[model samples]
Target: MTSNSPDRPATAHPGTPVRGRAHPPRHRQGPSPEEGELLRPLTRRQIADRMGELGELYTRTTPSGRRKPPSGRPFSSDPSALLAPSPQARSAAFLRRLAEHMRRPGFELLVAEATRPSGATVLTACAYGFPVLGDDTWWQELDGHLPANLPDLAAPGGLFVIGDILVERRVRTQDQSRDWNLARRLQKRLLSDHTAAVGVTLVDRGDTDTVAALLSWGWRCLPSADRRLLVLR
Candidate 1:
């Protein structure tokens, strides 16, 4: 599914077709809190499928013209990339929809971003009872530098051990072999320490390999899911 409308001016008529805006912001009405909890403990494949659906929804509603390649293929520098009227709205809606989907189950949402604004938006959503974890330069840091200060998610009874967890790992570049390796290692470590449900969001600029590697690490692949995680090298 994809959207083809253009960006709407801030003061445009309410009835105007907004480029990336969902008619009612799906989160406004989603699964009840109890249902969210029930959905929280879903398998990796389930979570991926859910996220994929949200992504499809975003693409469906986002104007094709706005899908421009990044300058020099660099990560988008504009904060609006994560929340503006075009792609931002779709992205925000994706987060909101995910939150709503997990709201009923009280699943904790962990979003890791390469940029500050993306993390901020995810954290903001997390503040509403969703569990959020983030790192600035997360991709760079995860590539080779494992943080000594990293939280002990594996600690028994730690905050990291939450039923139904969503971990978003956003990638902006193609040279992510080291990062993928580290992420797989970390996932192995986390699985050993915690029994809570876990899922990952391998957000990429366009390189499917990045997402593919992440999924192949341990996450059960779901054809129904849109994102593909490749096995880390």
Candidate 2:
């Protein structure tokens, strides 16, 4: 289903067709949220198909998607930063990642997708988010990655956790005048910082675009794991 949202300026990328600016800014409505997960790991082809849909969507929505890496190959502006050599490689890598994370009992895949004018569904963004229902031992696996200062998200009563978020570059950077539009929509219905907190692993060179928004929107940040894991409560 489509989400009923305020009109958003239509954003076009390299491969997408552009209309005359003489016509006025077009309105692109935001998409509704989708909540589901791959119950198990996917085969290489299945992963490729899933990622191709997201790649096209990412490329179509963001202006930066127009800028290709030196290799002259296309890549999704986000998540591929997880260190795959190419978009195709990223698909296989993501399959492995989903396998590791989803196999755990509590994690879920949360995505928001919209339909393009051509009737194709584009994934606007995705987050590895869910309730923290596992035991304290879960922290043991992550202990080596952070410093001692991280907040305890697995406190007695588990909290809702947003492990990672990868948003389509265009939805985030499309309208600079309203940089937070996409962020606002996703967080509004999903977060209650008082009881829900998000944890993210940040390397020194990664995209920190959403960090400022997370903090400015009232999430208290606690740095840990040699400052690698940033927990927002």
Candidate 3:
């Protein structure tokens, strides 16, 4: 949704190297270890238990790859700053929204995990959403007229709202670029149960990068007066 940005985190390019961490040596001998495997959908309780870790993932994968320092302090130079958890207030607010959304009927949450060669499982990506009810309530939020064909997609069996999709950052090389595709898979898994339903989400009007990425992924933009309304059939 526009309030949350796009499904995928609008972060640094996954292929960019972070200043503090050393890139793991790649083993071209077999499949890459960073490739994520979809996990079973999570329940609200499971999400509660892992909220801290999820918050870190959200912070680390943000546009700057680090949290903003409080108003009076200078940015930290500590190497660990690159992997620091999100600021408490911001993280709490984000988790609150996730929890609130989970309360909606038909809500579904999916997370993808990848294993390091060292055998540690890491959160790779996440996506969650619910079916939109067959009513005019949701459409009334927009300022302009809806596209003619769009309403058909929102009929009884046709619309699913993709609340958010988040992906973690990883150092990458040409041969181990698989981590970048995790967002797509998370979304695909999110929609797997809703056969023939069109997926819809919103993005901030100024978020050109996200809009470009969605367009590249085959989602088309529907005309809207303010925020962008994107749909995937």
Candidate 4:
């Protein structure tokens, strides 16, 4: 995708070195009605179709050789890896500009996380008034903290706005299988619930193959758009 600014260079190109900590690209302008028309409305059946499409894309685009490091590595184990400090600073700056575009009142922000958050990322989300939804693991820990029954994926009001997509891949311990059916289930539920408007930030162990395998299940890999919403500075 082309950067809106003529002066800025494109971030993704063939043979670019992979940064251990890459800042998400800037957000493209919100999808126009024409583009929105292209996306099927969120429905359980449609969600399944999208998931299949994503899975096929992931499998086809990612090769098996590009596997991520083992879970014991620093980046793989640390939740903070989801947010690089330098990228966070840039993201904060971007948020300021984004706020200008969100002039309508009563917009509520939600930050979805697949695992426990780092102190820094938590602080940042709080600073921005974004409600945190710690999926699966976090939900289990804090489920008691929320209401007895959280509503299904329906946006509470038309006011729901996702600030970022956080992808967290769970490592297989000795007892845990490498299978990712649970992750795929959660991903589909969220996507179907939110429609395709929510921006997703994929946080994995930098395993392109494994990540691709997960993405193949139904996740969209629009890094550029994610960068715009999640990365601010």
Q: Which stretches of candidate 2 lie over 4 Å from their true place?
A: 1-84, 141-153, 174-180, 192-221
Off by over 4 Å in 3: 1-36, 64-89, 169-180
Q: Output the worst ten-in-a-row residue range by lDDT, candidate 2.
A: 32-41
Clashing pairs in 2: 62-170, 146-225, 146-226, 147-224, 147-225, 147-226
- The Cα local distance difference test for each model comes to 0.36, 0.47, 0.67, 0.32
Which lDDT tens digits does candidate 1 get at residues 179-200?
Answer: 2433333443443334433433
TM-score of each: 0.27, 0.49, 0.67, 0.23
How many pairs of residues collide in each model?
A: 19, 6, 1, 17
- Return the lDDT, model 3, position 68: 52
lDDT of 4 by residue, 50-161 (tens): 4433333223322333234445654455555554335334444445533542343332222222222352311001101122232423123322433222312213421123
Off by over 4 Å in 1: 1-85, 111-233
Candidate 3 residue 136 Cα shift, in angstroms, is: 6.0
Task: Arrange candidates, best lDDT first.
Answer: 3, 2, 1, 4
List, residue by residue over 83-168, the lDDT tens digit for candidate 3. 54546755676688788878887888887786778989878767788877657466776665577766777677578888776654
